[model samples]
Target chain A: MNPVGRIGLIVTVTAVAIHFTGVAYAQADFEGIWNPQHPPRMGQPDPASVRLTPEGQAEYESYGPDKDPTLRCLMPGIPLGLVDPYPLEIVQQDHQILLLYEHFHQVRRIFMDGREAPDHWLPSIGGYSTGHWEGETLVVRTTLMSPDNYTWTNGFPYSGDEDAYVIERYRRDGDELTFTGEVHDPRYYEEPYVVNGRWNFAPDGEIWEYECIPEFGGIQ
Target chain B: MLFIGFSATAHHNGATYFDISTELEHSDATVVSYDLVNPHGRLVYVFMDDEGNEVEWRAELPSANNARRRGLGGDLFRPGDRLTALTGSPSRSGANFMRLTRVLFANGDVAQITGRNAGVVRAGTE
Candidate 1:
């Protein structure tokens, strides 16, 4: 082969590699502002139908909207914030995924770089997330959530299991994103509870501050 | 027609405090102020009762961000602006707590302020 032809072949191969590399990184794009196509209800079986354990039943009976921490301008926590009515923005990077929720101005981080969650960690509102891509789907395992957080605004509380784990699956299509979560709480729930929601890609939407100040007190 | 005649409500424990199945009769009111806050917003206004006594009513709304998306702001209703409001039933029988659904200003302007749940006819449009 001529020397000039050999150089041309090398250049062509390099260009192809670069093009495919870009596509590989782009295959798992979850970056965008999104809102549910239809507003989502809390979780499966309705609160009226949920079979709570004795302790959970008592907590359910005693709790009311007045006792809701959100009334005090506190974070709604984990699954609640995940499906908040306001728009949510997802920013993806090589090693991390950042979620900015317009509600409560909550920011959540999901580690993407092969880092495992600590065996023992403090509880938090958004909890600790470690995510990996399964084909086009993003699967996240979150734990260490604050026990004080209620699963729903309607007074249904989580079982507060220190080992309570939440598994969430996120998938994105052309203009739609779907999220499904499973709460494994052996302490207070008769069985694993499921929560699912759908969000559409909102290119024109922007996240806004939902500052919950303490001064407002009518419903609290 | 894909999106018409459908009402969307924001995320809140509405069923916890308000009767989702009941709606109050439309009332004639004069606006006092608009409280755009988190968790929910409140519309403060007064109306004349059947006994001709002044009654102050507080109507709950969606969060400020939802309201902003719906084109509602603190300046939408002035203190003396006369409006007809369609409200939802209150949890308490006599309490003035109600969910503001639609509002019609006397000046030929009709605005539907239903949060999360919209698509109802404007109060005077029907």
Candidate 2:
């Protein structure tokens, strides 16, 4: 073939390759608004059921309602926000997964671009999250969370702070998504605490804005 | 790097605001008003004391978003509407303050406004 014919064939092959790649990424559909099956606030776990260290037990017992930081309009951190009453939206891209919770308008990003956690990074309430897909399940690992943050509400300490670790597995079955999370904090619990919940897909549902007005009863 | 707006609303520890150890006093009262605002919803009502004197009661519920989701909106109540409430026992023996439990409207409408124990009421409260 002539030079022009050869160039035309190369362009056609490149276009086909790009189209197939786009289709491959689109196959993982975890995007949409979802509501947890049961949003747990109170009656989550009895103190006896939680295996706490001596220091952890003292911290939990010292939690005073008036001194609660969340009442002052602070972040409730992980697991608590995961099963909030308001719906959360999941937006997946090639490089990351974004979680947008309706309550307090919290947003969490799970990087999927093959980056390792940085050393001596600043602690964050949302922590540093990295995710990978295992077949249909998306497993996420989060670390470097702020020590001041609470793993579960009511003063469940996440004292691990810089060393705090969280692993979450998200699996989608039809329109229902299940979240199984494990939190490990050597400074708090004697063992990893498990968190389980479900979210149903809501195509037409929208997570309304949660504008917190202090002194107006900002509970969560 | 994309951060979405987060409002510090909903999911506060109820134990801090309420005395959960004591039983909620189930009483029949009249809906004086309901402020369906953000942060939290307030329900104002009046009930009769042991001596038959009128006692005003103000209770807090979940956020407007959760209330709206449970079919309890601004239009749900009006002044003079009869309601059955499970009120939180006051910290002091005779304090007039009461926290709210599930609310039963005169029209047979029931809402678990407290945001917990959904669809399940105390064995005898229902």
Candidate 3:
């Protein structure tokens, strides 16, 4: 081959390799066990900051620790489950991401296969999650949560109806993971509820089995 | 290495059951039973009142796993083990219940069971 032709081919191959490497880097790797770097403070929103509607205000007023579903061993659901003071494992696959929490043995699957919620889907505590990657952050949108659940911020208020939804952004930087979320429920609040949390990579961390028996202490 | 940042935020709100602002102390308490379980660990013990009457108290500790990591074992407090000091938040309902915070073993060891200073154990008399 001519010298100029050989040089051109080499340049083309190197450019292709670099491009693929950039693509791989863009797909952040968040698969590992993570221990919370700080306490997961989900529902501790400032009462003055939260703009609750009349229904939400009424529900907040009626809130009591005795009525906390968690005391009954009910699943804490989204923001609460995500911020619990326990270790969690993140497993990423080509089509979905799985979050395995040591709290209440909760497991959440975030579908990435471009699927939509069924028209007649039943609401659940964990709800339905769909995720996509933008740059190095994983953005997830969750909906169809059960209305029976509670949102703990300034006060423990009932979660809004089926229309309640949550949007979460997860970004990993070195050994640190940052999470930000927005809870939207027009029925409950005049503004979206926002929360932030952080976790550190636990190289030797393991998720243990969680068996919640509400009658353990006989206090209830 | 010890893991920190496991906050006091557990399954239920502690304020609902205990008066967190007040601290109650029991010295030379005899352990009746210790159930190391999830959600929270319960420690039942008996101490003498000012009138020399035996009083039974139930104190809540962290989960079994968190307790283990903080140097508490199932056998750490046996049926007859004596605690040099047991301090916690008293129950608001006027019951003999508390949210355990610090435990001082008869041998001088100390375990901070909850709060910002949780997961710390100081060896004593070894």
Candidate 4:
């Protein structure tokens, strides 16, 4: 083909790729404004799993509320953000999932859609989350976390171990998409810990940045 | 994950009280039929079924000062019992994870491992 013709073809191909990428992001829940349709807050609360035994209670009590992670601006990490009742925008890519949260505007990247979990994984604040489709759910299993960064808002909380698995089941019915998760901490809980909540889709919802500022003296 | 059946009760602001401790421990909870929203200041929350969905509660974090010594004793469950809970704390949506501050059990029993008693154990030599 002539130089002019070849140039036009390349441009056309690039445009097609870009258009497809935009379409893909537009179709995902992670990329739009999402509000918690059913969160486990105390009043008419929706909680995660509950299996904190007496022993588990003892251990957890030692780590009581004053040291709550949210009191600080620490990252809520991977699957934790999914249930944290914050609006998050997902910047989806062919190989990675960028989880953006409204809580702190914290963003987590998961290499889903066929990328290998990193070897020599670093102990992360949120760790790492990888996902794929299992029928209607996008099953995600996370690993490589340091138990020091998370908080337990229910019967039992994640202790940041290899055995601690966070599973996310996401599905959409009509305009709203629902994502539920189960956190299993074998050492803490006596059974398969499960928690449930839902989301309301806001196609027009916009993501605002989260800026956490520490109290200068006694002010939060 | 399973959605355990919720205990039916009424609370303030048209909120219904439900115990998820049993659900988390024993029964598989179905979708929690409640309003989910952006957590204003929650330490942790869970994604029951939505990708960006979250819920808050009471929990014990690692910073409770003297937790390592106050270890878990007498297994609370036998691997198949259900435990559900409810929390007042909301999730901090911008963090790496969510937290539930004060955890309660299925039978209206709140978890308390706060080491009302304290002791220590020596490491055994191999």
Note each model's CA RMSD in angstroms: 6.5, 8.8, 6.4, 19.2
lDDT of 2 by residue, A1-220 (tens): 9999999999999888766553223235789999767435422455457888899899888865544444556666664454555688999888788999887888898888667678866777777888877888888898877766676666676775556699998898999988788888877889877767678899998989877655656232
Best-to-worst TM-score order? 3, 1, 2, 4
lDDT of 2 by residue, B30-81 (tens): 8788777666777778888677888886767667787777766787667888
Between candidates 1 and 4, the DockQ winner: 1
Candidate 4 segments whose C-alpha is farther than 4 A from its true place: A1-30, A40-49, A53-55, A78-80, A216-220, B1-126
Docking class of 1: acceptable
Native-to-model Cα distance after best TM-score fit, residue A110 in candidate 3, in Å: 0.4
- The total number of steric clashes, by the backbone 3 Å criterion, in model 1 comes to 5
Among residues 3 or more apart in sequence or in different chains, the pairs in candidate 1 whose N, CA or C atoms overlap within 3 Å are B8-B116, B8-B117, B9-B116, B9-B117, B10-B116
Tens-place lDDT digits, model 3, residues B10-126:
323665666666677888899999998876789999989888999998988877766776567677678999898888877777788888888888877787777555754657533
Please state the Cα-based DockQ of model 1 relative to the true two-chain complex: 0.32
TM-score of 2: 0.76
What's the best-to-worst order under DockQ? 1, 2, 3, 4
Clashing pairs in 2: A104-B6, A104-B7, A105-B5, A105-B6, A105-B7, A106-B6, A220-B10, A220-B12
Q: Which regions of candidate 1 deviate over 4 angstroms?
A: A1-27, A39-45, B1-11, B92-94, B115-126
* Predicted model with the maximum lDDT: 3
Residue A148, candidate 3: alpha-carbon lDDT: 73
Q: Give each prediction's DockQ, rounded to 2 decimals.
A: 0.32, 0.28, 0.22, 0.02
lDDT of 1 by residue, B39-62 (tens): 677778888877888888788776
- TM-scores for the candidates: 0.82, 0.76, 0.83, 0.52
Model 3: how large is the Cα RMSD against the reference? Answer: 6.4
